[model samples]
Target: MTEQSEMYVLAIDQGTTSTRAVVVDHDGRIIATGQKEHEQIFPRSGWVEHDAKEIWKNTRTVVGKALVDAEINRHQLAAVGITNQRETAVVWDKSTGEPVYNAIVWQDTRTQKICDELAGEDGPDKYKDRAGLPLATYFAGPKVKWILDNVDGAREKAEAGELLMGTIDTWLLWNLTGGTDGGVHITDVTNASRTLLMNIDTLDWNEDIASDMGIPMSMLPEIRSSSEVYGKGRKRGLLIDTPIAGALGDQHAAMLGQACFEVGMGKNTYGTGNFLLVNTGDKPVHSDNGLLTTVAYKLGDAAPAYALEGSVAVTGSLVQWVRDNLGLITDAPQIEDLATQVDNSGGLFIVPAFSGLFAPHWRSDARGAMVGMTRFHNKSHIARAVLEATAFQSQEVVEAIEADAESVGVELTELKVDGGMVMNETLMQFQADILGVPVVRPEVIETTALGAAYAAGLAVGFWDGIEDIGRNWSEDKRWEPQMDEETRERYLRLWKKAVERTLDWMDDDVEELFR
Candidate 1:
């Protein structure tokens, strides 16, 4: 046996915009990392796609690069865990292992019409009780249906059991486990819950939902616990022979990575989208608020735990738009300095409903808007408003969470945050000020990858238990509320007004553009 100190866990974080591989040691510290960005395909105004082949190739390259950077080989690795952007759907040939169409991203709103059709007279809330998610284009089921209905011969292939379907995690897993040779097609409870086909209580695919969607059950992956030895890496590049031990949707993994084991403890992850999830213990708490109830994580043979998640469709991606589309900034990080140049936004407010508002307001008709822009406002002011937009959106979700938690007799006092955008101290302070709660950041901001590694480590005995992983968490910084209550209220009022303007932008004309 390799010495405990010598063994490491490799976590693959397949996200919406990029694929990252991180190698973590026994102490839950990242030893080395490698990342690759993939193209974001937009077939039309509201449609999004990704080349599954590119993502898989990038995953292998990043994993090999990360291992080489860490000066480690397959022998020193205890296991591999996967954390991915939840709800991105992929359908592929079972025998050949080739994707039938481009992967439909979670942010793609191409299925709004399909979701509307599913809602029917009963409305979007019809599926809320059964699936713990409202009928929105921001899920996997409708995306899967879109592929089957639109892609020629896909429905026939799926019904004939010649094809397999899964989210990004399952796609990576199948390829890593030897694709055509003997790939295991499975997804964790966390990812399955986002599909809108899985029953929250049973933790299995709901036959009624599947039948209603006209989806063949044969195409769905086998549901599994989050932490267990799913299979061994077979033909995967440098990962061959390593145990594939853990699987989690990215947000669930972040919650675990933050050590939010107890109920009411939560963490907010800022990636392509922003998600705030609070551990709701073992039993699922159906939300009266717009937040979606989901599986936090399920270990081997244990009952599944639940979480209430407030998902924002856009946050960090808004920054990317400013850098890419607008060209106001040369790089994403440059926005921080530019925004800092101005003490305030100069009456500008950016409502980034790029993919529609998620959580609290699941309005698919909404569109991005910039209101209250004055002629005197400069690019710095626009940048400030752009950064402030994330904080303001987070405040909306936090308020909704507080309302829901209070209804259930749980009071959330603070927030634990992680993700790439958390590195911006200015935004962190603004978030704290807006929420009027202390925002705490961990010593390691790569919690998404670390969370996956921790799960794999536990399954393979690299770490004894959750307590060992908890001890690895240490606070690096804390931001307290500084703005006066009056000022905060004034800013929030303006934000609400701006959000109202973004709504109903997806009218007949816009809908026609999508088709």
Candidate 2:
């Protein structure tokens, strides 16, 4: 094998809004990076889509750009790792490699009626025990079912085994490895766990669920470990022959990247949404506290570790809505500057239930709202409230996690945070204050990509083991709670009040508008 120190891992992070590629050296430092944003297609109110072809194109573009930026070639990369938005379902023809329909984003709520029907028949928690998920539109199974039922000739093709279904990670992996030319169809346990079709205990597709949902079992991918050489890269624009080694859902990758290997260690990723996952060791702890039981990651043939996940539907995306829809700010980053101008939200609260609340309070009926706003409040206050919304949402999840952990006799001491929004010092500090725990930001904030890189590098013998990657983790900054108990209580109260106002928003009139 080549000296472990010399090889690089090309980690691809295909996200909701963008595609990014980064080259990481053995020491876990990002040598070079490239990123490109894609369009957010909203076919109608409460629906979202992404062109899989455009995503594939963006993947190639970013990979080429990263290689150029890093001054490296395909031969220099030891392996490729992929991390992507989980639960975004895509189905395509096996022969043509074209998606049957635009990829259904995880945030899309068009399947709510489908979910409601299923839950109504089987009860909302019917599959929760086996699948480790609730009957919600946030999962891949309903989305896949929606496409198969809605799209033209999809069911026939799927049942005939002429189609394939997978999450974004599986789609990218197939395209990266060989596309229509013998591309391997597979997904890691971490990604598979998000799909309601997978049995969390068996670590495979649940045949019963598949049958019940009317989904053809043949369309599913072979489940694989999070780290393994699935196949050799082929026909990729800039990468060829290199091993495609690792894959994870983005949030799971962040947990691995943060090196939260030990039980009770947790991390919060503030991406398009906010997700808090705590490593729950080998056994999946079924959450009675409105969290999801998920596979954190399964290394090569080892016992699949479990996690309790608190998924918030909207956080950073709220910032984008303020910028693009409301014109409150020109760019995402300016929210910080504008928000800092205010002492507080000026008694206003922004419950960005734009896609409804997720985690702890899975209120799909909720909608976006700016409550308690008066003439005295300005955009700066709204901006500050917007930023605070992320922190507040996270705090809700953390509270639930703490409750779940307490049941398991584990107490969380600190939170490890990563992702784009972690760069916002105000948000981080406020998050810390809200939880009353120190929020530690790793030196490598791009832990999602780094985690994928580590997985790929490990699989290809570029590193010794998990210990080697653990050494790469270093704390760059830490924020401790600053607000007094009274202030904290007041903020929580107002935030809860604002959240309550967003509920039951999809009334008959609103539903009629969408129709």
Candidate 3:
């Protein structure tokens, strides 16, 4: 048999916007890929939801499509891996395996009131130490608390151990492995960190934090390492006995995808949101700089490697807002062409803290705003400003990472780029120009899926080592800084001024809700 016929790895990437599957060969080349976008539910402002059934429907459809595209039997697959949007919460029945409600997505800010209340009454500082995360609406804990409190009989059922709570990964795993028919409910450490239920130290669901959040200890899923055979693959009519190995939050998986094994190596993924992660080796380096410490990834059952992460609630979504909301551009790709029309932003910067400013700032009252707009500014200038805003956000995150790393004596030199936004060469150059570092884009654009593939491949003996995976990776582009230091500094200063104006815009808007 040919190499293609011998072994293949299947990766399921459950992201913020879609569910996708990629079939990879032993050479690490993607032979089959299928993507399906699903609906986004908005019950109220800042609230987002996805039907768990819809997610599973998409997941099954893509896997079938990928298998067909590869023209291979399911038996050829040696193992399956999964990567997902972290912090998204879903609760389902243990016996019947059906969702109680729509999956509460990570971006949903409905729990903002709960977060505000926690942050005020001496709960923020206390939980931050225990969980290594702030009391934020962006995480899973508040969302879990929301469901337990607001939904009738939900809390009582959960406390009675009739329910199962999980992030997206666990939900997928449970369903894929024949839900309730010996189904497995397990989540990787990376996803667990975003839930605020897991103690970053012990890597287990903490009873103290669970008590504080008012979530029943019984509803939680078992936490597993990022890469290990957690269960079997049981896809209805087409069941494969491949080891269900590897799972992680999308961004953390991308860090491993970039082979950021050494300290100071980092990656910034630009998608619906932007996440910047810096590998800090074995030690879980606590952040004094308003950033979050999270599990990078785990190999087998060993302690999960750690990293510090900073999040921007909006990135490419801002461009989508202008196109989809303002009807400015025909498509998201038009943003690059439109932005290229302007030499500069004409003194405009957009702070898309649509939800809130995360990391380094941690200001929930900061709302989305466009600053320094003048009569000279048109859509082109606005487009340029939007792209530059993403870069400025990264600059802010890097500065925060620098400060935190300094407290622990680590210095970063470069960043690995991935996700949908990095496809624009113009944006990559502008990002490099602003940061004064060579921005490296890998030959593979879908590192999130690839990371999942690599993790699963490792477990099934299809791949040799992490070093082999790194060696197989190739670079497609390298962006170098071309801007003068003076110009860079001038833009940086103006960006800072713009950020200051955005900080407290929603203080009054959120007052009634927080009350």
Candidate 4:
């Protein structure tokens, strides 16, 4: 066994594109990491899925690789933390640990019709007061309902108390603790807040909402706080008997990893999608705007910290589209270089509503559109348009946040950022320019995993408390606004016009084409 001073915590970051394991020491530095991408399954145009079992297998593989890379064994590990893609749901047999259907990704829009039917005459925000979320396809509750209604025998099995449904965090935690052998089935408040089933105020499942969605309460996991000893690793796994102490949705974990402890402190994570979250202290701040009120994190039995979140469905993934689908760049990093080739988008705007727009405009009928394109524009100019789209979308979300926070007297001065896309200098500078605020990056940009490790460390006495974790955060770089206000406003005006072209695109004719 290692001494307390030398012990390390491991974080399993099960993301949308990949599963990663990071080993972090007491100083909040990433000592070692292991990552592997999983296959993305698209059965139809609007549906996205992942193999739940493959994600579990990759989780174990990455953990083993990270431990070996760190030159440590299970005994040297203080605790295990898990942070994962929120709203990606899985339904599995409790006894067999096999998924009933493919894990429906958060990006999937198969449940739009379900959400519409549920909204009925009250519209999308019908249950917003109790749920703090509009009925949408981006959440997990409808996804669970989809599985039950479509999958053969899933409803029967669920009603009989044999099926289990959870986000990726719950799926990974259940298996990490012990699969098919007394595995603890649980999820943290952060993940539960995105499910549309858990009441944001009570932090418990709303039987009315679940019943409305035609979901069985028996399939839901026990909702727990973000930090605490959930269970121990299974005897068969590499982390045998180690305390599994922390679980958070990837965005909430990023907020914690950034050490945003004070009210009004916020962070933006640029990943497959971009999520901006601002801490609202102990009480939930209802948003009249498009923002969603969610539980930021709950530590042990402490009151849960709430947040107003603006979720954009496409950001970094747009870069992937440019690279893979458009063939504009051979790799993701090349996008920055390509974008810099042109002074601007050369009068081109790409509204990447590939899976419909999220955030301030929850237009499920919207589709991807590339407007303001001239014959003079080239691929390099297109690259600039792609990167600019991300910044514009983020700016809209920030404006909505500002509008909502006016009542509470909370203001966001700077945005702490993390995730793979932060490395793009072009995007970061533009993000700051558009928002007219400083965008700061931390020394450790892998805050998602680090946040999970912090929770685990605090829970198991590996670290003293939030203050100890806060001391480890240090700024690495900052980008200040450079574009003139006049020019920025002009560009934003054009971007909004481009966005308008995407709305109401999925009419009956469009839906019939997919069918």
Candidate 5:
């Protein structure tokens, strides 16, 4: 047996664009990491899919690569934590270990009609009171419905209790434990809360909601706390027999990794999208604003911590568009350098409603628009606009959070930031300037992976407690607001104008094409 000192925690982060395996030592530092990006399948203009088999294969590969890089075996691993892109639904056969269809990505907007039908009469907020989420295409429930309704034999298989439904976290968890054999099918409170099928208060699947969607109760994974010994790794895997203890949605994992355990503390993770979550403590704080009330995390046998989250659908992905779609920059990081060449966007405002706006304003009818473009505006100006778009979107969510938190007297003094986009100094500075608050970055930017490691380590007693996790957190750098109130207000006004131009752009004709 490996000594306690020699043991480490492993975190598998199955993200929107990639899968990553990270090894964390006792000091909360990442020792080794392996990452691989899977293909983003866009079958139509608004539909997004991922090959679940490919994701699973990548997961295995990364795990082995990380273990080999760290010069460790399965015996040295104390436990395994799984964090994933939340709300991406996968319905697989329980016996075959094969996905029924490609996994529906969270960003996919093909379920708009389903969402509309679900929102009939009562509108999108029909289930918001119970599920803490609007009936939007951004969630898993509608996506699951789309698959069952469209795919041949899917509904029959689901009703026959042969298919199992789960988000990316649940999918990874089942495969990691032992797919088609004895895999423990379960999801944490955080991930479950994102699905419209789960009752937010009870922390369980709402049978009424499932019945409404024509989904079988058997297809749902067992709900579990964020930290617990769910199961062990499969015999054939690199983490064979190691405890698979923790699972969380990527954003919630970032919250835990940022150590925002206290009520009123919050963190904003800039990734494929920007998710800003503010801890609202034990009892759920229902949002009057467009924010979603969600489970932050639930440690083993402990009451769940709740949060108010504002999700922006497009942030870093917009940068990807500028890189891949437009030939503005060769690399993602290079955009920062080009953006710095221009002091501002030169009156250009980009509303990246690429897949529609999320949080504060849930408008699926909206589409991407670049307003205030002039002949004088060059690639540098476009780069600046692209980076500023992320900041502006985040600001909108922060405002919504503040409004929702105000009733409870919870205020956000500062924001703890993380993710791939946080490395861009240009964007970080602009984020602070636009928010009018200091933005702090931690020494570990990949909080999503670290948070999962903390959960797994805690469940297996590799770490003492939440306080132990807190001690490991330290600030790497800080960005203070530099823009004056007058300038900030002016930029905000222009941005709002640009956003308005995007709305209702996907009108009747656009709806016809999708249908």
Candidate 6:
């Protein structure tokens, strides 16, 4: 295919806070895009959910709008790729194609007690080592188990094989393929690795773990590679046969989008929270750093590529807190200018341990803490600190990544970054300064969608090799270290003390504190 006449690929990014659809030309230019925010359900304290139907509705609305905006026929689109929030569990009726329960979001802390109980009971750490994930509430297994135990009649139906269980990717794929008629329930390897269900090496549903959770394997979706033709989609008048060629968890897609093919390279996606992924090559680097070893991607069910992932429970949400809860700003993006107005945080550090510190710090009992707060610590300083906190937490993660990589003789010179937070130049610069390395921002910050699209495009003969992806990558800006050594040390010192104070405060249930 020539550069100009290359086929168009569409990617659906089903995120925690929103749903988006983008049309990318063969040249990697975003021809059209549409985004819609869905309602977040907080039925009980520490429990978070989403209406699966609402998610599908927004997906359809955005896809239609994006296709119209690009003035491209749906038939002309070569394929559709899906990149979604991982570990969010959904159970729906197999016959009616309707969700039986709301989607348990990744951010929900409802299954913490169950996770704690299960992690302590095992003789072997079989779940983590084999699945390439921890037995955390953030993963799907505990949440799936929780619903089966608590939700009325759920376990019975599951036993009788009346229910279908899937991560968001599988649920979305089923809907996109015209529901029950399609009879296509599947998940990509990347998303499957996030659930504490699939074996990392075997890349299939593990019987032992399912028996531990008392979940039936019959309810599970078929696991596939990140790229393949899964099924087709049908709407009112449009019977589109677009190949469902790719599906991946969001951060892994961003890794591919940034073209981080070689080992030791990393990408940080600044989503609602933060996710740092380091390509650990084909071998699963079982982390001693409290990081989750996960599938990077799979090439047509071949041996799966692996990565070490560090998840920060809060990053961008700190700013969202100020806007939605504190009413400091009308919008989150405005926090950048407000934060830059202040020279420093005035000795105040906001440790957003809101959802408990993730990655290396696995303490679920941690709570958000603000220290060294004099009366002079106003909104500007608070804004600066919050933004700085995001960088600091990410720095902690990078430290773990660096320390872990060193054991395997890998060195990180730069970090490839994408996601909504990269749009803030101030935060990007601060992240670079704190890490004391270059933070490279790509021209297409929408790397998540692009990653999915590229995978799909590659699967169907649109491209010849991964080198084509690397050649398409171009930097919009590269941020180098700017802060002095003394300032870095002082900031780090304060954050350490602040973190010391936050732990164990959550020893009790978070629902009580939330109330």
- Give Cα-based local distance difference scores for all models: 0.92, 0.91, 0.86, 0.93, 0.92, 0.86
Error of 2 at 451 (Å): 0.7
Give the per-residue lDDT of model 3 (tens digit) for 1-515: 53644879999999988899999877678889989999988877677899989999999899988999988766788889999998999998898888888899888777877877766768565687778898888899889889888888888889889999999999999988889888888888899999988888888888987887788877888888888888887756444676788788899888777888777778899999899998888878888888898889988855568889989888988988999889889899999999999898989889888887887787777878898978988999999998999999998898888888666566766678999999988889999999998899988878888889889888777787888888878889999899999999999999988888887666554656743
Q: Indicate whether candidate 4 or candidate 6 has the larger TM-score.
A: 4
Model 3: worst 10 consecutive residues (lDDT sum): 506-515
Q: Indicate the worst ten consecutive residues by lDDT in candidate 1.
A: 403-412
lDDT of 6 by residue, 41-64 (tens): 989766789999999899988898
Poorly placed runs, candidate 5 (over 4 Å)? 513-515
| Backbone Cα, N, C clashes tallied per candidate | 0, 0, 0, 0, 0, 0
Where does candidate 2 stray beyond 4 Å?
1-3
lDDT (Cα, tens digit) per residue for candidate 1, span 227-273: 99999998636877889999999999998899999888899998777
Candidate 5 residues 458-485, lDDT tens each?
9999999999999999999999999999
lDDT for model 1: 0.92
User: Least lDDT summed over 10 consecutive residues: which range in candidate 6?
Assistant: 232-241
RMSD of each: 1.0, 1.2, 1.9, 0.9, 1.0, 1.9
- Put down candidate 2 lDDT per residue, 1-515, tens digits, no spaces: 65556669999999999999999998899999999999999989889999999999999999999999999888889999999999999999989999999999999988888888888767778899999999888999999999999998999999989999999999998988888899999999999999898889889889998887889999999999999999988864678899999999999999889998988888999999999999889988898899999999988877888999999989989999989998988999999999999888888888888777889988889998988978999889989999899999999998888777666556878889999999999999999898888999999999999989888888888888989989999999999899899989988988898888999888779989766
Residue pairs with colliding backbones in model 1 are none
Name the candidate, 2 or 3, with the larger lDDT value: 2
TM-score of each model, paired residue for residue: 0.99, 0.98, 0.96, 0.99, 0.99, 0.96
For model 1 the TM-score comes to: 0.99
Clashing pairs in 2: none
Best by lDDT: 4
